[model samples]
Target chain A: MGRIPWRLMFAHFRRNKLRAALTVGSVFMAVLIFGFLRTFIVGMETSLAECSANRIISASRLSLFAHMPKSLEPEITELAEGKAEITAFTWYGGIYIDSDPKHYWGRFGTHPESFKKVYGPDLILEEDAWQKWTDLRQGCIIGSDLANDENLKLGDRVHLTGNIFSGEVDLEVVGIYRSKVRSFDQKTLFFNWDYLNETSKAAGGRKDCVSTYCMLLKNAADSGPLSAKIDAAFENSPHRTMTQTERAFQAQFNSMWGNLPLFFGILGGVVLLACLMVTTNTMMLNARERIQETGVLKTLGFTKGTLLVLTLTESLLLCMFGGLLAMFIVQSVDGEILMFVIASVPPSTIWLGLGIATALGLVSGFFPARLVSRLEIVEALRRRA
Target chain B: MSDNALLRFQGVDKIYKRGDEELHVLAGLDMAVNAGEFLALMGPSGCGKSTILNLAGGLDTPDAGTVTFGGEDIGALSDAGRAGWRSRNVGFIFQAYNLIPVLTARQNVALPLLLTPLGSKARKEQAERALRIVGLGDRMEHYPNQLSGGQEQRVASARALATDPRLLLADEPTGDLDATSAKDILDLLQRLNRENGKTIVMVTHDPAAAERAHRTLKLDKGRLVHSTGAAH
Candidate 1:
């Protein structure tokens, strides 16, 4: 068997610059959309995956909208039976120190000791920042993005207006933390729960109330048994409790995107189908133009198999070039948009784009390659057009 | 046309069918060429002259009868087998100089030899030798687009001679050339036949071109009707 003439095949692409550009552009767009859709899906899922695995969330039996009594914290913690651990936090729903209505960051109030125990080690901090965070009474920990966005750093005093608490609270910025996990660390601001509770009591609001408790199973494998025990302990309480894995808790937030994945899947399929059509059209035109060349090859001792492989190789080369271009663009731009859109994009999304481009090349090249292989050499040679 | 016959076509017929119409292109044609003879197939357009050359070159199969090259029945062989046979025993020159546009003249000439077991270095040497034979040794590095029409056809001739095939099939080798280039190509074909003992079968509409062959056979209505030559 003769060696494949790869240079000859590439020369065909080089000779027809406009046609090659159009075909490659179609492939680039296809891969770009594929990468975009894949990144969104992976981003949403990563948000759930990045949730603290050691943290278990306890909410109301009915829904997250229902609140639990602060009095139940001790009862829930006692049910641990040395095989579980616990911490508690409340959603603060606070606006930024800046007056802009659109300036929102994740704000939560938690017991300082338990919050530090569960998350302190993972929150890679600047030197002395962790000590300052633990020592100061009015200090709040903010994400690096939040600090950068508001120009707030260590020892900067800032006032946050709580939407749910109905008052402005003065807090000193003690530390800035970046996410070890992609999702949680990027958007949160943490303050002492006692401050909010004390303020609510002074304002004659509900005193013995908190939103959620986070538990840690002693053995990761004991999550199921520990969850069942926690739920059983609070079964008949005035405010009933629901215990679930951290993943399920985060997934509740994802449910808000309802039917989005399905919509994106359908949209992605349409884009890929359009890409296939464009690729097929381009390949068909290519095959028609090279009929005489193929005939020449056939007469020069190239078998149908060789012809098929060559044509398909040419198509795959075209698509792979576009795939690389798309990959470059996505790698360059996806990080910034994703940080704003959904916080972070996963590496798997890039891999998925590459896989999709490969599959697209094969599927799209099939018909045209087959047509070239099955062509009669005499007829093809005779077909001047 | 017995044991020494290099090619034999016996009662060969090719009929092309389009929708409800039948076009009998080669109707029960029988012909034979000796080992070192140069035969010209001459006729007007649509007279199946090219078709005969195509059959003789093993580029197409006869529908009804046997077309044999070197004792092997070409019609009975598979497509790959026919291709292998053509690569080993036949070389073709087209009027338009069907050289791969990107390849240099030497690379184009080396194409048919790629089927041989020769290494790349050896293939290059043989290709250079064939180019030298066609008086294009210095022009071997030039691409088809870079060379003149006559130079391109000479490169095509060099390519045809590269495989050391016994038979050379030229389909109007000078059909796309000027008078000078056409004469150059015909003179090369005559030298290849007389000196190298290659069996040459060419299809041409030009009488001047046909006059250079060892024998000229005219086809009319899918059958060889007239022959003027020493019957060998």
Candidate 2:
């Protein structure tokens, strides 16, 4: 036929309503999940890409879990020779009333003044919030997302029971910070490192120790020499330190989740393949039902190519419609849905998901279209009759 | 025969295999259908009445010899080429009506016209004309399920006539219809032949339906065993 009648292709759906809906619904869920999971990997990648090159994080040489003595900061400061400003980070992994990951946020204890100065650009705060936290003994600044999730107002008390530092700690909220640079997470609560040491000393636990020392260099080029000097200074000490650029440091944290891009790629690929198989099965069922109709079309002078096009178009339409809907749904989704997993699905990921869906449609549609093309007209007509 | 024949089969053999055994559906069949003729093929079940129809329409190829239309060997054409040829020259009406349930009578009638160069408006107009010819003008907008058995068959007839094909093949067109509906279909077929000058080859076991044709041929085990002069 010159232009194959689209209605004929659409008729398969009209005749068997349930099968068509199910096929489209499967495609929708596949695209949605793929896009949703892809957001996490994309977010991690974005954060790693945005890390400041000028900063170096000094951590325990043994592992992320091992802590280095805070006294080592002065040795690193001397090695930098006034070329860098230093602050320390103590990861206070804590749980709010419940232990669910959704209710969790990064709790870091760092020198309030030095942390504020080092991360000046990343942390957006009110001018008075810093002065208030500076004056208050037990004050903390929380991320914008954490403030919103916990609905904590300024001067409101926030309590946490820590795993690393032990016992319970209560603090007043002094500020809420927002960050465009993702490495400085928006879901963290930064408190005075002295407060953590004091509490630990009071509880008879080890004090004046930190997870990482963050050194902000005056020149980004000095990162290499400064990092090497800092490592060598603590190499033989009981509290040995490993030092790297902030970018590499953030990358190491991301590596904790394995090869992120490959992990999500494989996860999404598996979902799409599973979707293709399901669509192929659905298409096969449709072809079986339309065997007689296709034979009649053949008898009416429809070529094998025309029949194949018809079948493929049906499959493509289902996937395209579902994928387009899923893409939009991912774009407009509320941040709370993936609160702990991902901040939001980026535009690039949405387009990528749609592309994957379209390819799945074309490849999946081919199997059944090939079957339709090879059907013997007489055999089909006879078989159906 | 060469001057007048629209379709010709010479020494044709068709065999179908069932696992290990071969069924010879047609054996050295020889026949010709002249232009402007109404020919009926009658036979018992499994007697190859429909096989000849299938061969005539280029739906299947013969194992030996040739089936030609207007002196062109259909078996020689590629599958796609034959489909084009069928679109241009052949129209078929089936016993079960075989109408796509979703399409209206006019749309079903316009199916073959999609292969032509006609614009959508022209195809629609031609489909309406065909429906009116089969006395179903009022039912043109109705779908197959919405119409009665006879009306559905009339829509099928309209479909067969829509392309203005040189040959029309009906495979027991009234097999599923009541006697009244069957007679109505036979009357419509007869009118198409005697008035419109369409060349039709209809397959049927109904002697009553066969009597409306200009001539009747009977097949037994794929061979022409009996023949009757023009019934009209």
Candidate 3:
């Protein structure tokens, strides 16, 4: 046994800078893409895990896009039988600023008082702002992320043009609420349902409708039974209801993308395979170029195992460097945009990236190291090219 | 030859096969070199000059008979045992000045000492001393490609002598050098053999190179055909 030739192993990289750079760059790109794909999968899991255990979401049997009569909330509450608190809201789908036609975001119409009561501390709204919002008919609350991004403050007037309704509605930004959950913060803009109804009726449009209802149970364990009861009560109605826990509701919304996460997962795996092949080829080329040197080292009394370790260390160093670079780049990029896309790259993702890179290094370098170690000294010396 | 020679080849045989043809490189060869001897083996092409060096250095084993060094039969040792023996007892010099291109002269000279338990600082100091002995102390930081043919051979010589081994095996040590460089390398080998009391077995085809050794043995086909007077 001998000390590892650390300087010699790294000196090979200096001799073949272009090849080393290409190998490292390929690993960097592959692992970064893998990290993003994994982030999306983890982000969905985090969203579901953060859902309130005591809350149940009730939607139309057709889809969340399908509307139900606002009058049905009382019937659903009766089914709860004094055991739950309920609230309802519909998707507004508003476009911000006429000049920036692509600058669109979520705008939801809700019963503000019930929405606050149901959400409780999860939605942090100041008392003064809450009082202001309740006093005005056209007042709305925006998420802190949206408020900071759009430079909107309290007392600022906002005129949103609805995508589904025929006319524009004027509203006042009375409060900014910060969500405990990051995914919720990036997408929230809540306006009064009564204001929406009045505006639509004044413009001769349809009114008094909501797309979904949410119920908060007295005991979290009763969600399953209460959800079944609520659905059974509305089972024979014209608009049949489908009720489930909030976690399950989020999962359904996630499934609407239809195998996209799975597709990205497969794509990430393919990228990893490509990286392994490329890295293997790079190491093979490196070993071939150093055949004579390997023979010389053997004659200098280096054991076959020492040669194998040296070669493997070279590949591992390259991959580790690439993994760190990719993680830094991913983390240093815009966080708000990443959160908006529902892809949250956590600190643990960096560790995962490094672990995968190390595995890649080991697999890619195995054959090349074996080939180098098994080289016959006479044949290696005789090889000219 | 004396009974207590430092290296002994007894009825040694070596053969190589190329598809269907069997080439008998060395057949029943017998030779001996006493302690502190400078022996030069010379002959025409394909005379098994390098094969003898390989067998003596434990790089290759004979098909039959035994090659003995320091009273032990090297052919009887296991692969790992033979490798350990070579590291502790033998130093080799090749014609191509086979330095690892990526390493500096100091690093190349220090390579053999890596197998020993010497720390990095001690190894570096010993390598520097070896380089200075070969008159290349200032060139220790230069790479093989950065040195001349003569300087590169000096570095190779430094690397070979760095381990202070019991026997030095050289195969065409000056084959790739110019006349001036060849003379310098031959002079350095002769000094190492005579002044340092190191037993050396060099294989070369050059008559002028053979003249520098204390004894010269000529080989044809596989057996020794002629011998010069010896000082051993």
Candidate 4:
């Protein structure tokens, strides 16, 4: 065996620039789609990983749309004492104060003290922000993203036209909170519960009706026993409830998308397989052109292993270039499109590009390397260039 | 011949099978070459001259009998064994010059030395020495595409001599060259045989090329029938 001539192998790729570029382009497209698909799944999971550990969501027995009676909040709080911290919130579905139709944010109505206790880790405060938030009666805490989008500062006043309550309410932005986790705190708008209860009572809507209660357990491990206790407490009540960890609660929202991860997985696989076929075809043509070169090397005393390694290295190198290109393109465009489509992109998607490129290298190179290794030196040399 | 015989072929045969049909190219061929001899093998096309060369160089195996080199039966060796032996003991010069297009003359010459256990520096030095022997010391850095056909053939000769092989096999080394380049290649082969004491087995159809050999053997249908010493 001879020393591997990497330069020699690389020269083959350099000579056919167009073919190499096309092969690499195919791989790039495949890996880019792979990255997109993977980012979607990770984005969904990240919403879970980023959810507040101190907050739990309690919903109906069958679905999130099932409501619970506001009377249960006291009993739930009594049972949660010492073992957990409890907060109650109802989805308000408030309309945006701005004229932009696309501007929508999650609005929740809750008791300020309990909400602060449950979300303390997630809150980002300005100077004297907590004092201002607790002192004002019409105070609201807005996500940093919402603040930026609507150009609202800490002292700014904003009005919401409630979709569910059907009235206009003015609230002062006393604080702006940003989540350390991805996209979690960026989309929520929090306001006082008294405003919501008063508006609903005046409108003769369901005043004692609440969508869910959020419980913060002392330990994450205690969630299983505590969830059972909460559910058992409401088992015979007029409106029975189901309590779950924040992760499972977020996952239930994912289930509404209906096997989306499996769909993306299948799409990623098909694109990669198509890319593999294109790569294999390109490599076969390249290998055919090098038949004479292979013979020359064999005649010069290069063994079968050397030829195989050289050919496969060439394929792998091409794929690596493609992978890098795909990563660059995905990193550049994914942020804007993801924020539009699914609200955020996850970092773990980078590995998807690398994995697809590696698999393409191996799968595409297999037949070409074997063909080069089995070529008869005499016959190969006799081949017309 | 007994004391100096570097290559010997005894009753060697090569048969190619295409489905049920058998094509016998070399039928029980017997030949021998001694050290320091320049032997020319001349024949018409399909006379099995190249087949004999392939057998002796360990590029192809004989179906029967034995092709031996320096007492080892090459026909009986495994593919890897044959490759190892060929790298250490045999150097080949093809009519096409066969220099790897991407590599410069120096790299092409150093190719055979790569099969040896020599380090990179040592391989370069040996390759330079071989190029100097072929009078192409200045052209070592030029790629095959940069050189003329004559220069490329000279580089091929340098590659053949790089590993200090005991036998040099040339298959129509002057076939693709002009008349002057062909003469220069023959002169190099003659010098390698006479001055360096390297065994040379060359196949050619040109009588002028054969005239440079110390002995000429004619093969007709795999049988060697006529031979003449250089003095004749």
Stretches off by above 4 angstroms in model 4 are A16-25, A28-32, A46-114, A121-127, A134-249, A320-357, B230-232
Ranking by DockQ: 2, 3, 1, 4
**Clash count, candidate 1:** 0
Q: What TM value does chain A in model 1 reach? A: 0.72
Scored by TM against the true chain B, the candidates give: 0.97, 0.97, 0.98, 0.96
**What tens digits encode model 1's per-residue C-alpha lDDT throughout A1-385?**
4666666677788788788898889989988877777776777777677776666788988778666788888787777776656677788776774656446666777876777666665677765766666677677888887778678888888777766775566889888888676656455678878887777667665455678888766577777777888788778866777888888887775676677689889988898889889988888888888888888888888778878888888888888888888977877654332523453445776777777777778887898899888988888777763
Cα lDDT of model 4 by residue, B1-232, tens digit: 3556789988988988889998888898887898788899999998899998888898888999899998889988877778888888999999988888878899889888878999989999999999988889899899888999999999999999999999999999999999999999999999988888889999999999999988999988878889877521
Kindly provide the TM-score of model 1 when superposed on the true structure, using C-alpha atoms. Answer: 0.78
Instruction: Provide the TM-score for each candidate, comma-separated.
Output: 0.78, 0.85, 0.88, 0.77
Residue A312, model 2: lDDT of 87
Highest TM-score, which number? Answer: 3
lDDT of 3: 0.85
**Whole-model lDDT per candidate:** 0.81, 0.85, 0.85, 0.82
RMSD of 2: 3.9
User: Which residue pairs show backbone clashes in model 2?
Assistant: none
Backbone clash count for every predicted candidate, in the order shown: 0, 0, 0, 0
Model 2 lDDT per residue over B28-90, tens place: 999999888899999889889899999999999999989999999999999999999999999
**CAPRI tier of model 3:** medium
List candidate 3 stretches off by more than 4 Å: A67-83, A95-105, A136-187, A193-209, A219-240, A260-265, A324-353
Q: Sort all candidates by TM-score, best to worst.
A: 3, 2, 1, 4
